[model samples]
Target: MFHWLEKHPFFFAVGVFVTIAFAGLIEIVPNFAQASQPVIGTKPYTTLQLAGRHVYIKNSCNACHSQLIRPFKAETDRYGDYSLSGEYAFDRPFLWGSKRTGPDLHRVGNYRTTDWHENHMKDPVSVVPGSIMPGYPWLFENEADVETAYAEQLTVKNVFSVPYNTPLPMKDGSKVTVVLADTLSDAQASALEEAKLVAADMKDKSVQDAVAAGKIPEIVALIAYMNSLK
Candidate 1:
């Protein structure tokens, strides 16, 4: 069979390409499928967190901070565990940033609290003295686009099979579900409900008033998104 194919240049090239393609599939497909599974403790982002992810993206937070943590003893000790592929299974465009003007935020939720984020975003130097990261006072003034976020959520749920509203297993063997609202208004309400929780931990009256008035500030959404990084 090899001799016969080698005699025909066209057939020989086709055979080589086919062989390489098959080999590539073997090396790539299984790892992809396995990595795509949600980590045992990983849950889908809620309406508020999803909106905050958008806020983070809108302000280009990923440009300054990476969401991925390298597997080094120094890195894990500072940034918690090394990142896993399954942990980002639900991320549409994973924020595994390349630059690090700030810090690795893959496990920010593990160490930082809501109040801490509020203070940090408002004035980075306040939290980390002499920090070069600029303050995002606009995040406090701007409102999160929960509408667009919900639309994107609907698209991912229907087309991508993101497993929203499904019970996901936790590290401690408990189960949690993230609901995607049916109506746009319901999505807004659900997002507002969660924003209130984040606001409860925050000291900023402006952020609190925005959440109470059913207007989620970009900072609130960004904080919620950052808090869900774990």
Candidate 2:
């Protein structure tokens, strides 16, 4: 068979291509699947965090910031650790931006606080001197679409099995369970409760008042989402 194939270059080339392709698939597929599983400590986003993710996408924050951190000295030094594929297992549509106009936020929740995000969203320059990013004053005024966020949670939970109610392991050897309310009203109430926690750390009166009134402003949701990045 080897001698016969050598006599015909076309067949030989085809045989070689098939052999290589099969070898590549065998080597790649299993590793890819394993790497794509959620990391030991990774958890699904809560209702408020998911709502904030909607706001983040709605405002095109992904256009300026990237969630991926490359395995490089400079990137790791600035953006915490390098990103792992398992870390994004729960993200329905990954936000690994192509270009970074601002900075990587995969670990921003570790370094940045609620108050810092509040001030930065209201006035970017106030928090970071000489920041070119524009203030998103409208986020503070607009009411967060909690209903829509809840709808997405249901879709992902039912269709994708995101494990919202399941207990997830953490790096510190603890477990955390993200609740996905069975009803829309319950979800909204839970989101409001989470928003109040974020509002407590913020100095913005309007944001605080809105959460107090049982209304979630976009800023609060956005902050919750931002804080969950870690």
Error of 2 at 108 (Å): 0.3
* Best-performing candidate as measured by lDDT: 2
The global C-alpha lDDT for each of the candidates, from Candidate 1 onward, is 0.90, 0.92
RMSD of 1: 1.2
Candidate 1 backbone collisions, by pair: none
Candidate 1 per-residue lDDT, tens place, 172-208, comes to 9999888999899999998998989889999999888
Instruction: Give candidate 1 misplaced runs (Cα > 4 Å).
Output: 1-4
Name the 10 consecutive residues with the lowest summed lDDT in model 1. 206-215
TM-score each candidate: 0.96, 0.91
Off by over 4 Å in 2: 1-21
